[model samples]
Target: MDIFERKPVNHAIHTSPSNDLRLVESAIPDIQPHECLIHVRATGICGSDVHFWKHGHIGDMVVTGDNGLGHESAGVVLKVGADVTKFKPGDRVALECGIPCSKPTCYFCRTGQYNACPDVVFFSTPPHHGTLRRYHAHPEAWLHHLPDNLSFEEGSLLEPLTVALAGIDRSGLRLADPIVICGAGPIGLVTLLAANAAGAEPIVITDLDEGRLAKAKELVPRVRPVKAALGEDAKGFAGRIVSELGQEAKLVMECTGVEASIHAGIYSARFGGSVFVIGVGKDMLTFPFMHLSSREIDLRFQYRYHDIYPKSISVAAAGLVDLKPLVSHRFQLEDGIKAFETASNPASKAIKVQIVDE
Candidate 1:
């Protein structure tokens, strides 16, 4: 071995049944010929992480044991297997959680859309562990080398930024497309950033929480923020958005999985426009099929992401968008339990809570 892998135990945070999370030590993972070991520097707590911690599963992936729970992460290279040439020890890199099977026979992989590969093993998604630990091992190809200008915190945020970029790309947004985003949370905020970068103008964002709406306006001053009133009908909500923007939106990005928000996005869109859904909602949603079909609205969906890390990193490096303000809270690895608690509850007003190595 070229590098001395001396650590015998790695302390990691895991989620168990009954909303339990604890810090425990386990043996450091071994690196394969094409893999590299990373000493985790920072990991961001995601909404999915909170869902898994509270319910022990997000749909079908249950936390049977002390399952790790994080995917948005960045760290330094600790060791690299013999065949790893892209990175070496002390290199800084951001981790991409999903490892898709790149076999040529797989249709998705054959078309360079590996994010849709059914055989992908994404971190923190059942049976597979995540990067919210002292050390992690990943295939070299999935990691993106971070520039010296990007801090570990900024690097951790690239995951969600890539998601936003992927959503915008999938939506096929055109220049100056009037867009409405249905939520002002992390995903929605990042989507706004992506839209603005893509030349989408006069964007409108909605959320029930006034604070989030305010934060959205603060982050992107040009974005028109609207607060969703309680029990507001889709038509009424859409009317408010249209009235605010002075015209019906050409693109509606549904970042909230709430069925009502989805409906609002549909109705807010202009005739023959598109509604891109980025949030993962229920398996089955009862939508206004007749209305959407009659209006000829294009309903699109964006999965996690595909081949966007490089572009996302490049954009972030170039200051095309400022993501640093999105990180609202921070906790050490040992205080991960508190991190989860804060993320689960909205009292902390946390847009993105990051966990740093102690």
Candidate 2:
């Protein structure tokens, strides 16, 4: 191998939702010239990872065969494509998982919505490998420049943060608008942070998990993190929110794709309020569309993200976002299995977990 060649490594991990994941040694990766080689320093375990690990699939994306399982990550540039610009070896950075697949002329891509580009290839899903290894080779355009002040773990979380930002942006939150965020997982808290920066009034987070909810409150005192504990009164809870908030929310961001959360967001919104949905739940659910439509509610589903990376990067680079509190756990490359196992558990002491390079 040439000294500059970004060769594949000897480590990888595979998983399913129902089965405990295992680490496997596989081909590392080789970099093409238009690509860059990243020595991954950190990788996050997203809810999607848990879904895949526990169920062996997420909707249509299945783990029937060999594949690595990670998407959010940061790393160091070990090599660069012959035509690569804006990055060089030794530049520490985060990896953007979505790559424009075969077609480059997609409407989503033409408009810089590469995240929604149907032609884009992504990591850790079926038919495409992920970044759960020591090294990965990817296109240069997808490698984001990380600011020196940010840790690799924070940089790795930029993907989910961007998603949260996009969801909030879609809702068009005004300074005084109220927010009801369903689900207090990493994505939910990221949304809370984004809403907080936007000056949205009183972000309310709902979740069944106490640990996750507690962590969210620690990050933002202004955030009203409420645990929808078992035996808790849903109607009473709704009424209290109305009493405390003064009115129905102008914006509802559903971070948990569960059916219950979806309904909660619907009823939580003020008549005609907009709800931006980024949560991925079961394919279908029974919803009160008649009531929603009667109220003229604008329920919009925000797919990944569109034309938001640069904006998100700027926010992080300029210090507008404090991401340190979001990452609750981390692991080195050698501890890949533990990382996956920890990430797979909802009760595990992690809001967001990462895999770091030694």
Candidate 3:
């Protein structure tokens, strides 16, 4: 098949309101004047995608109809619109996935925090289609060129890396700073890599799964992995983290949405420290308000990333982080439903599951 030739049928994976997945065929999308039509080569299955697949909604964002699922993706440019100037056919690129309003008066977009723009169109989120299809059209400005050293899989992983970068930036992490990471999931693991690259030392990461903790230790040999004991209270888990680090952490990166994990993060931080929440939990969460308040520990929350793609790509290209080790499973696009099933299953021990197009 010619790379530039558009296929007659575009195969896409979508989640319906019935809580089922389907591989459907549709017409290839056309590019706008400033857009580029990309042939998606790789897409990572995110937890949110799985949540939507099983529950038919995330929070108030309901899937009233069939919605394509996938946001972390990489592709080769098949065609560029008349106004597209930075890219040509055959250029490899990673999709940023969030399209925020660029209006000058939009406070969030004008200030460079476009991720918080009220009118932003986020892929895989309810009401907006995503990049799971074979061909997707996106604005050239939203796509970053993939370097020669990075594979399409690595390019797809950049989206989650951006989240880690944003969290690290928001935490004000410094050289050799002692830190605690809650949850050893994909986000937590990527945050560990980012923290190591930033020169943080004696990092302690916690998770309920011993396998994931073992993987975390394998990824960062110097990292101290702490396993959460079954039936242990939040305070007890927090004590365990402190004991493992020999002191309270100055910054806690809470990557799990579990309430116990969140509480443990708050309790594990030292006085005047900060706990940055990167996970998406329930709408209402009850926390130890007085405990955090009395200790002056700032509780910060992070949404999707803003403008960290360039840094993420640079970090990957420079070999500061090896993304390949994180991918535990892979499948072709035709088996996307099975991919989701494996990702959602705990017994599979899957870290980052990806669907690739041959």
Candidate 4:
């Protein structure tokens, strides 16, 4: 062990079914041989984290036990396994939120569909702990090294960026394809960038938050933002799209996961266009499938990524996408609870909140 090895410490946050939250310090997790210990440098609190805090259980999988939840993360390599060769101490890296089963024959595992692996362990979800700690340990292969130019905060976002990449990749987006992205949250903006990178000619975004909508416009000026209000009817959504862009979009990537937004994306997509569902909302949504079918809309689901980290890093490094602008709030490792609460608040106008380990 390194003479300066920091002792692992525990920290936790609890979320009630109705959205109440509490912060506490607990015990540290152990590092296994195939794993590496990472002193988390920065982690972004995802919408799912807020959902768990607010709704307790999303669908059938409820977080019945105590666990650290922040998953969109970046950290420094504190210790590497004896046989590890890809990385070493001091390497800045990002952690993929999901952990797949090691068993190769598990259908999804054998097909590189690890995200669907039945035995996968993920942070803050039930029995599995998370990286929101003084130290976190995970298998070495799951870690992705970050470039020198990317800040820890930006590095922590590889997960979201990769999600955007996967969405665009699956959409079969090509040069000059126009896109309409619903919801201008971090994922929405990231998906816009992914679409922009994939040669999608015109990228339009829709959101209820004007500030977030503006940020999306500022970052990617070509990305037109359609501001709307939260309402039961689709009038706000439909009016904004028609007035702003003047035509139906060929691609609609739904990042909001809200029932209304999902319906809007389904309606907005032109005939034979695609809709990539990148956000997580109610598991069961009431839908008008006949209309979507008539439009020949191809609905795609965005799960956690497979092997897009290296490309995400490269895209950030190449300046094809610079995510630093999205991170508007930050906190130290000791103040994770406060960070998550801030992240959960829509009024905070928060884009991204990072937990700094240092």
By lDDT, the best candidate is: 3
lDDT of 1 by residue, 177-289 (tens): 89999999999999888898889989999999999999898888999998998799889998999999889989999998889999999999888999999887876789899
lDDT of 2 at 103: 55
lDDT of 2 by residue, 1-358 (tens): 6433644455767764446677877765677879987787888888887777777777777777766788988889988989998899989887888787535567767776667666568888776878877778989877888888888888888989989988877777899788888888889888888888889887788888888878778877877766675654555566655665667888988888877667767887888898778888897678877978899999889877766777777887777778887877778777878876787666776788778775
Q: Which regions of candidate 2 fall more than 4 Å away from where they truly are?
A: 1-9, 16-20, 102-104, 231-236
List the candidates' TM-scores in order: 0.96, 0.92, 0.98, 0.93
Top candidate by TM-score? 3
lDDT per residue for candidate 4 within 17-118, as digits (tens), equals 445666666655567778887877788888888777777776776867664577888888878887678889989888886888869679998897788898
lDDT scores of the candidates, listed in order: 0.89, 0.79, 0.92, 0.79
Q: Which of the two candidates, 1 or 3, achieves a greater TM-score against the reference?
A: 3
> What TM-score quantifies how close candidate 1 is to the native fold?
0.96
Which pairs, if any, clash in model 4?
none
Per-prediction count of colliding residue pairs? 0, 16, 0, 0
Ranking by TM-score: 3, 1, 4, 2
The TM-score obtained by model 4 is 0.93
In model 4, where is the ten-residue run with the lowest total lDDT? 2-11
- Candidate 1 residue runs with Cα over 4 Å from true position: 1-9
Report how far off residue 215 is in candidate 3 (Å).
Answer: 0.7
Which residue pairs come into collision in candidate 3?
A: none
